[model samples]
Target chain A: MQNTSLSQANPTSEDTSKPRKARGPKWWIDFLVDLAGIYLFVVRFFKDLFRPPYEFKEVLNQCYIIGYKTLPLIAFTAYIGGIVFTRQSRPSLESFGAVSWLPSLVGVGIIRSLGPLIAGLIGAGKIASNIGAELGSMKVTEQIDAMEVSGTNPFTFLVITRVLACSLMLPILVIFTDILALLGGFTNVYFGEGVSFSLYFSQAFSTIEMEDIFASTLKSVLFGFSIGIIGCYKGFTSKKGTVGVGKAANSSVVMSMFMVFVIDLFTLQIMTFIRNILYS
Target chain B: MADTKSNFIKPLFDYEGRSRVVEIEGLNKSFGDNHVLKNISMELYEGENLVVLGRSGTGKSVLIKCIVGLLTPDSGKLEVFGQQIPGMKSYQMDAIRKKIGFSFQLSALYDSMTVRQNIEFPLKRNVHGLTQAEINQRVEEALDNVGLLYAIDLMPVELSGGMKKRVGIARTLILNPEIMLYDEPTSGLDPITAGEINELILQVQEQYHTSAIIITHDITCARMTGNRINFMYEGEFVLKGTFEELSHIDDYRIKPFFEYNEF
Candidate 1:
């Protein structure tokens, strides 16, 4: 054993060499690779969801964190948004002698588009960054690796639970945002025009169709998925060190928001196309 | 390279009358033109501590990671308990992983969990059908083994460096693994703390009768824990012997490590 061959072993003589820079591929190539990685992540998540020992406890914990913890901030922002929009629209409607339309207009806008979009963006910023940073730190510290070597599936415990929580919770949070925003709108309309609460709500409900509610709820679901998946992907693939954690958190927020807009655009187009087919 | 197929037929413990738990042959790992491990080969037998001593970046940690199937080698034959690691699927690797415990350099305790929770994590996951009482009993036993029973309820953030390492070892020992892979187990501790860790490692090995691969630069740790020492330089094993045998070696690459007087 002492005569173990060293013919192929070339000893490193000096330690003066600079650490190699991690040269990334071109932007387009990087984008394609990231897209592929996210696609695979989604595929793996679906594959693992049906497997045994579902992480129900972790899922509930995440829902508490992602949904319950986010209510105050989401509600506060949505309420302010509703008041600001109503105030901005009041003068224009009053000039056009369409003040009576205030309840219907704001109600339709809040229920159909503004509510889900704003709530989705808020969830993306709050929940996405939270998940990213938490998991990035775990990766950096080898907690994730420890979990794996201990025969626990980190993907099932960490990624699937978080993604499901965000996807399920975001829609519920958006409903809450829509209701709060309408209340805020009602308050503004009452002060501005002395509209009775009964009359204002009647007008509000009269203009919001089943299709509008359905479309917005569906959009929120997609937004939630994008936010959860993007956040998990960024974190799971984080490189070594604290800088990697920061990057993961930053990019999770940015990418989730970007995907929100992209999903919004596609959902609107698809809704319009379906409506056209039905009417035609 | 010399008829390793015959090794498969040989009884699991028949490598010179000692059972081989981990076998590596012609292992090569490279990171984008920078060769980290070059045709490395070694064997870890049962009931013995195998220490690999090397500089910080000489692939010691990488070798252990590969053994645990965390890092896929470029090309090599890595068999942990007769299972080919590089080609094994996730579930297969997971099955093998259950029998092996890896204690990371930083202890890698979960910051969100208390010491008790961290130790119970593996037990709850791997050993099914255990009641909570049984789990708690095992957690206590593991912590007691590492002399950290008093720190059970404390979170990882509250523990000092040596305390964290003890907790980490306790967490790994909870599974009662057959093979242990330790990555720089005493790299950042003070001298006294480092000596304590080394003694704890020795006690654990003797008590559990498990084979281990400890990668470290600490001479005291190497001397205290290793039954055989492999001196790695530039991703290759430059020498292999006992501490006393290697101290007298004339090779300059292997001389600096033994020259240090500090314990």
Candidate 2:
């Protein structure tokens, strides 16, 4: 009994005093634990999603937050990217005496790859980090536990709504980004080469195949889902105290950005494979 | 020696005739290599306040958390309302959770929501058929009970520490739970505010006829709110008695808790 009380009084000593066998590397153990946690989280999300009493109001509110609130930033980045890419490529095209291809060049670059990638990275930085911080603070404050005790499913109310909103809205944001980029490109072209609006748009749309639009939209949707899930998972598993919130937010952004790149790589490979099969 | 000591203490504080709302026998819980709870046993009867007095990190909070299904015991029996909590499914635990209100140490009010919204949240989720008017009435009544009716429209961030505790209590009481679990309910408050909270706890227990397991080190709170007191040390109840009975005991292990000079 005295030994038990002494052990309880100083837990660190008890832990260190015992000689225990190694259980693999610490990092590998942590990775496995994190992977299992994410798996459980995904399973819980789907379970709640298929169950009755869907949270439509919460989903719409999240859409308004994750989509409508993010338009300005997306528009700004797209516009800047379009102008810069057009300006940089114009000189080379002129040197090759193929300045007429400038519009199509910028269009394909912006629509097929740059637009979705940029939007996803932006969402990862903004929405993913924001959700992570928000939910991390909730966890620290026990608000999530309060929700659970109140008979409100925190997984459904917090995780599902945010995940669904991001997945559904990122594609829309990417489309909007593409449109803004094209408009910026057209503006630059009209001024630089004295091309008419009709001519510039025609050149741009001429090279944009149906496959390009489909693939880009698909990438955005997947990126959105990854960002949302990673953020929620990080925040949900955050440790106690204020520092945990900061760590959650930072890790969420980092992981989401990493996932975006990975997803983009696989998507491009899949798209190239399909194109080859169809046109070979 | 330990067995004989516990046997000598156990019969002196027996609560046999009353209906037990929560019962635990030989419960154990551990975190990594640290055993937080070991061979713990207690019973919370209907409409009684069981104050668990313990030093920091003595597993008092873990004990109540186990009762409320937040933390699973490593082994042994833990039954609440005759249902074993450890083996219960998520939905089943949630069903049981509706009857148990846990007031967290930090109040745990949703910062994004106003007090009215926080109070209304449980009613809207738990009581499906309640109309807006009925929900509003209940929210107001809960707020009124806590004497914070005016703070209803204000957000949790705008609330003071004492006010947040009151709002937490109001939110917990809104559902009229059969069991209330208060984890350090008055830990960080001023003495006056802590007294008010303790009084409010007693009032709620009496008014709602709910059994409560309040985990705290506050002697004033223990004296005011507890119908019976259980002093926990090293994950086991060292002594169980009324405040007056336990305070008068000459055991050195229990002496510091009653000694007023330290505070």
Relative to the true structure, how large is the alpha-carbon lDDT of every model?
0.87, 0.86
Query: In candidate 1 chain B, where is summed lDDT lowest over 10 consecutive residues?
Result: B3-12
| lDDT per residue (tens digit) for residues B1-263 in model 2 | 03233323332233556688999998989887778887787778877898998888889989887887778899999999999999899889989999999999999999888999889888887888988998899999999999999998999989899999999989988888999999999998999999999999999988998999999998889888997788887677777766776776777666887786355
Reproduced native contacts, each prediction: 0.30, 0.27
Worst window of 10 by summed lDDT in candidate 1 chain A = A1-10
List, residue by residue over A120-175, the lDDT tens digit for candidate 2.
99999999999999999999888998898777889888999999999999999999
What DockQ does predicted model 2 obtain? 0.36
Among the candidates, what TM-score does chain A have in each? 0.92, 0.89
Report the lDDT of model 2 for residue A235: 93
TM-score of model 2 (CA atoms)? 0.92
Clash-forming residue pairs, model 1: B13-B19
For candidate 2, the per-residue lDDT at B87 reads 82
Off by over 4 Å in 1: A1-24, B1-16
**What lDDT score is found at residue A274 in candidate 2?**
95
> Candidate 1 has what TM-score?
0.93
Output the lDDT of residue A224, model 1: 89
